[model samples]
Target chain A: MTESTNTPVIVLRGLKKHFGVGDAEQYALDGVDLTINKGEFVTIMGPSGSGKTTLLNVLGLLDTSIEGDYQLEGRAVNTLSKRQLARIRSRQIGFVFQSFNLINRLTVIENVALPLTYKGGLSHIKRLKKASEMLATFHLNEREYFLPYQLSGGQTQRVAIARALVNNPSIILADEPTGNLDSRASHIIMEELSDLHQRGNTIIMVTHNPDLTTYASRVITMLDGKIASDTDSLLGQPSVEFKRPLAMVVRPSTDNQAANSQTKPVVTTLSKVDRRKLKVAVRKRQQIAKNRAPARHAEEYHQ
Target chain B: MSRFLLSSHLQNARHSLRSNRSRTLLTILGIAIGVASITTIMSLGDGASQVVAQQISNLGGNLAIVRPGPSRTNFLTDITVPQGQNYATSTLTDSDVAAISALPHVKEIAPISVINSTITGQHSAPAGTPIVSTTPALSSVDGLQLDVGQFLDSNISQNTAVVGSNLARIIFGTTDALGQTAYIRGYNFTIIGVLKPLNQPINYNNIDFDNAIIIGQDIGRQLSNGSAQIQQINIRSDSAANLTSVVSSINKTLSAQHFGDKDFTVLANSDISQPTSELFYAVVGVTTSIAAISLFVGGIGIMNIMLVSVAERTREIGIRKAIGAHTTDIVWQFLIESLALSLSGGFLGYIAGYGLAFMISTALPFYPSFNWQIAAVSFGLSVLIGTIFGLYPAVRAARKDPIEALRYYS
Candidate 1:
């Protein structure tokens, strides 16, 4: 397909998701505005209760009933029915969970063909054939008949990736794709994801590891249910300095000059002790903010 | 509901069901027992009626049997009254037999007078060995065969008798005792014939001919003090086509002779096949209702197992939903599993039922029959039960929220 470089794939404005009622209410996602373009790999990092996973769920259309104006591919998704959203999820978006959710009873090929089984009109033979071809791309042809437990952690995640892409969805959503893997396995998964990015597939990944963000075209960091900083840097850098920003202003970007100008130079001199102290201080401030909203923090516990 | 998706769902269901082999087998066993009883009961009931029907056809379609009282008797009366004791209050007499014999199309008529008495012939026999007195036409009307000598002659109404094969053996010590003298009610009678052996004891005739003696009608009346009660009469028309006319005329003649009391029943064709009156339907109906209750219990067992299966597979449902399975897909997966369970049970029950039926039939007079209709009904009922019981659990699995489901650990 022919592609425009700056076409907006996802746009969210004033998106708010809250839990509980009245005095016990808490906003998991509070007034978040963001835009993701086609073929751009974005990585999100935040503290435990910062609504990063919730935002990913909303973007994947797995969660609904939120206050928002969200358009996917220029079509308003907030007005779509649950069934229509499911259709969009199956046909246009793919999700990769941290646990590598392959059905334990199914063989590797059958697990990879799980998504195609839900789509109408394809026979089981054809679905398996497609799954076999997808597995061949990952060099997993010999393990087609092996169950999930029989595969190593890296092979299992690769099978999950093959399953997610079996239908050739428009965007891939990975919620800590390497969460359960060791460094070497995580490196291999990151390289496969980068290869997918080089092939023009849009990827939105959630991770706690800072080193993996070097593969992203842009980086977004959230704090206290809101975007604390959004930057277009660290595409291929080895080390970087953290930006301490209090909710940066979000705007529509047609190659915005201000964001490019705010790109801080790489800092390779920061010690591990200094980074640890910065993380500890950030956590202490977050705890104080959570303490100030006593009712909301209590509700978060209930959730 | 696409064909491709249906096949895929079927494969998935098969895989899951096989994984839990013990549970599936136990659940299937419940349905099997229920279906087995139903099949066995149906086969036995149909087999008994088939035997009686075969006997009726063998006697030729031109025959009609007349007995005392109305043809339609209730279940209570049939069970309380022992076979021939119901004939005590019978209104039939020798005149009714004479009146029926005068009909236009009637070829031959034989009135049976059961004289209850003991006999002394070289060696004494049982006390209540019935001495049936009838005309020589009885041999033709009842399709009886003689092993030796001749049947009672109608022209010579003397003290001549024909003994059954078993009665001959009991009183005279041998079936070859053709010239044996038997004393009945203080009158001496010479045995002229020995009947051929008949294996059919449970027949419409209600008489075990193997232990009975046959004498002339005049002797039967003399023994009963000239007030002999005619218990039953068997009439045969010249041709099968003349049966309806002969039966109607006999009914009219008997009604007119008894001053239109209508106390006699003339039965032919379909009515001849009714064994032990209408008790056939009553027994079948009661037992079939019991079988239905068992099937209902079996259905409940299936529902319980399916609910447990759904609970155990909650995380599996979540994983499938996360991978893009719709609500209908999950529902069909479980539904198909239950269907597979019950349908296989039905098939096993069909084979087991026939085996049981054949085993029991060795003691019975008739063999149980096998047909496609019974197989079809067994399978149809199995499908219905599976659908009814599997639906709720399947729907529960389908309605689980994908987000909550994916987070489930078990």
Candidate 2:
């Protein structure tokens, strides 16, 4: 069970996930090969229905009915039982979703630390303490007892990310984690992810925003369930702008106030014509903020 | 999946039930009512049986009765024997009583004769009272305790009788009924004593002793065509330990007296109160089973609420699955939720059942005693029903695909 971090953490070769059978069969992930090494922040970009989610699901061990050779940490995962896969997923892979996916009935800390329940042998009190520390990392220590519904979109996403990393998973799989946040909140969340990346955590993110690739060490664009363009876009990375150290995000701050009451739906869920209008508005803002690199990055990443 | 974490699961289950207060309360009420009815019914059966057994034991530990046929008396059936061939027939005779009395380990015996004729003295009971005629030994053999006067002695005169406390008050209008005149079967007799209340009316033979008129055997035989049929003979052994041997010897003596016609029954060797107990068990069983239907309905309520809860929390299930929760985990969550509901209902039902039992014991003649078995059964039934009914819905919740659940709308 001891796996070194230097090994190729995930290797997906000829991964094909079909939705139906016979004439109705449609490939969700059609013959895609991708190998992600340790400490690599890989961002996946594609239009909707381009197999981005299916690929993420396959890698995360949430979907197994796919023909593929998925080797994780030098071990072949295809033959592993569901229980074993679940253990591996719990110990090594964490997931962050566009919807936050926090259980509405549980408090913020319970939602954050629920994945630890499957770990077994961990005292619940100690688990809560660990969850408290994880929440502190996102400057959310004060709101640990709040319910998911009581939280703002940004706070909910932070709680979700805290849950994902509570087990200390080496790889975090995020499916448009910032998709639900407002422009300001999205910047703060992305900044936290960037901090995590600097601390040598491997992250695989699926997003519709092509400009978010600037945060990734490698970017793979998909088309019709295939990797149409694989680019190692390291030069345009946001490393130069993140002058503050990663440890600073976890520092106790007295002024970290709650998010405002005003809330907006995740941009992707908006109607097509409204989304188009928003995108056009974002592009105009980007052009005006071209002189400012950080502002331009935020506009591109969100749009 | 690794560790059960029972406490945590219970806590979470309780939390979810609390979220829907009204539905949970209704479900609890359903199971509680069922439990209460079952407890009441069970108490009735237990109480009735205990009362009969205690009554039998009170007749003296070594005592046994030989009665005709399988006709044991219960309050639910006829309590006064009719005057006809059924009562006039000598299924047993005075010779049988003498023969049993002469057996090894045998003690003195008393044969009982019942006459459903009215006995009034200065006042009446408004209904015909039963008069029992037996020898002097009848008092000790049947464990009768007199309040004021001695029982019938060896007087050849048929002019003396004993009245029970209630009848004494109703007839002679006083507990000092000794030496008072009473009319029985158109014959005037002087009351020699007033009997204490027996506390119970039902006995082996169909006679309410508390309201009955007791007289010496010879006088009663003369009144009923110079000889009356002996309905039952009460036998008391020298030692309780030798009761079986005594009963066997009595049977042998009786069989020989009847030329080997074994038409009589010995109480210690047979189900003394079988028919009555069986009737009671049948009635209680049927009624309580109907009450159990309420528990079944309560379980269905839990399942209905759980199904709604699962559907409402589809996204929660998906999130949990994505975070490495096994199907077993999901199943346990829902199952525990359902269990919590039923068990709470059961607890409420237990309280309510005791309440109903109290009301019933007061309203009815049967004195109910506490029974742990009934509590155990009703509580266990609630939990069992919860598990059985909750399984399908819990399995359905577990079967949801993470992707599909994630996309589910409100």
Candidate 3:
């Protein structure tokens, strides 16, 4: 609930799910604890029957019989009604499935704009424009009029990603997004996810391939309905390294100005430049932030 | 849940129907046939009744026909004369006719003796011409007007006869048959008169006047070796106002003469027409029932196909439910689809039914005219059948589990 930079985007405490009752009961998810923070690309890796799907379903609000506390953006999700759950799912969660789940009868753009169509407060022209923009972002502008069956696996996944981004969701929950693609297609999809994560969008993907974890900032390994290992930096350190020279220079100036008077002019000039730059940066940041905020928050979980 | 999703469902249904065009057409054909049969039978039955009623009303109001039985029970069994009793036993006699004439409010009583006798003349009469023997009062009771010559006299001093216009045509080939001799069973009788042409053949007793040769009652009995008996007594009331009183007095007199056995019956116009009306209604009832069965079968076919459709679209149902569709909306969608099919079919069937009824009326001699009331009823019944049968399938579709349904493929 505190306004902390490390506040978890998703948190689950002591989650337990049983499929049946008494002797016939099957434990799908048992006593699981996990937390994912903002801007972190987390991949859940497990073999079949490890309850990866069950855990994903519980997080998505698609299934609600588990005994646990689920907090999304610091709000309890367990007590929400089905209608409220649907609203949360549509407004806050984006989903990319292994099978691409795009309605075959709808054109690519229509499939992407499906959530917006159901929400129905926007003008048709505006929704279409937004859908086109999302498609254009994924280099799928040419395939907008094509149905799901007309697109290649890679192209379909791109469209699915565009659909996820169309509603401007907060987090993307992908279940084996690259499972159905060839190696070349799989790499292209992972590259897109990595780029999206670097853009400050949080992603929680479930995959059986360990090689796919190279793209994630953190990897949570599951075994026998439990977390076996929470591996951070499975591929490398989190790709949050500052690339701009001004941001790098400003970081050293903060410490140097406090230490010596001889460096005052340099500090002052840099500070003035930093101030002007900060204003420009702040304005630029605000614009980019406004542009990207919706996509970041729109993703919840998809089954 | 959402208008977009609902529209999507309709789109899906349309697509499915189009994809399986032959199957869809077959189903529609099945329902159409059911609708058409029900509509045709009910409409035709109603039309027939109306036509019969109309024909009955065309006959004169004053005409009263008495048959051999007291009441029309089983006409073949109760009225057919036995071999031994045929000569001596008389149900209606000449004395009874005189008594009916003497009653108050009675205008005339014409005693008629009918026999299936062959006739011969200069020109041959048509085969199966009835030989009728009656008094001069027969013309007044029957409301008959002479076409050319006078009716028979009170006394049968000579062998003179009065013939129906059609019979006169056959015997003499022209209305100038006055004083022509017409032979009846080898006995020569002069045709002194010819009656006017009555377009309708006699219906009650199955007698045809177009081929009849009429003579004096005394002369007829003499020709039959004194075994000729009066089959019916034709009575005429003085006025429409005196009908009820005249019928009552005749019943009382006939009952007294028959030793309080009530072997003879006296009927007014309305009473005589009751059985015919009831017969018409019975036919309508039977045909309507048959039509109802076809409608029921059609409704069942709709329900069966709808159930299959719901199963096929299980995934779609789940998706809608997950998106927040209520149970009632799902039910309404399926129910509306069924009602649309049935009502459209009913409208077409109603038009077809009336067309068939019209054709029947023109093609068949005794077929009835079309009735709109029956058409309306058939239409309503088709809709009711749709609603009743569509309910369970709609409910089944509505109550499906979202999770399980979502998992279904194909």
RMSD of each: 10.9, 10.5, 14.5
lDDT (tens digit, per residue) of candidate 2 on A230-273: 55332333332311111100111235323322332111223566
User: Which one is best on lDDT?
Assistant: 1
Ten-residue region with minimum lDDT total, candidate 3 chain A: A242-251
TM-score versus the correct structure, for each prediction: 0.72, 0.75, 0.56
Chain A TM-score from candidate 2? 0.76
Displacement of residue A259 (Cα, Å) in model 1 is 34
iRMSD for every model: 1.4, 1.5, 3.7
> Where does the lowest 10-residue lDDT sum fall in candidate 2 chain B?
B76-85
Per-residue lDDT over B1-410 for candidate 3, one digit per residue giving the tens place of the 0 to 100 score: 45654664455456555555665555555456666766666555544444434434454566565545557555333223221123345587766777777888887777777766777777777765778888788776666678887888876555889888887777788767888888877778988788777653523323455568888888888877786677667777777777777877888888887778766666666544422323334544555555666677777877887788788778766655543455666686777666656775677777776676667657544453455666677667667876898789889998887667767888
The segments of candidate 1 whose C-alpha lies over 4 angstroms from its true place after superposition are A1-36, A61-86, A218-303, B61-142, B148-164, B167-194, B202-294
What does DockQ come to for candidate 1?
0.40
- Looking at model 1, residue B259 earns an lDDT score of 92
Q: Which 10 consecutive positions of candidate 1 chain B have the poorest summed lDDT?
A: B78-87
Error of 2 at B137 (Å): 5.1
Docking class of 2: acceptable
How close to the true structure is residue A67 of candidate 2, measured as C-alpha lDDT? 91
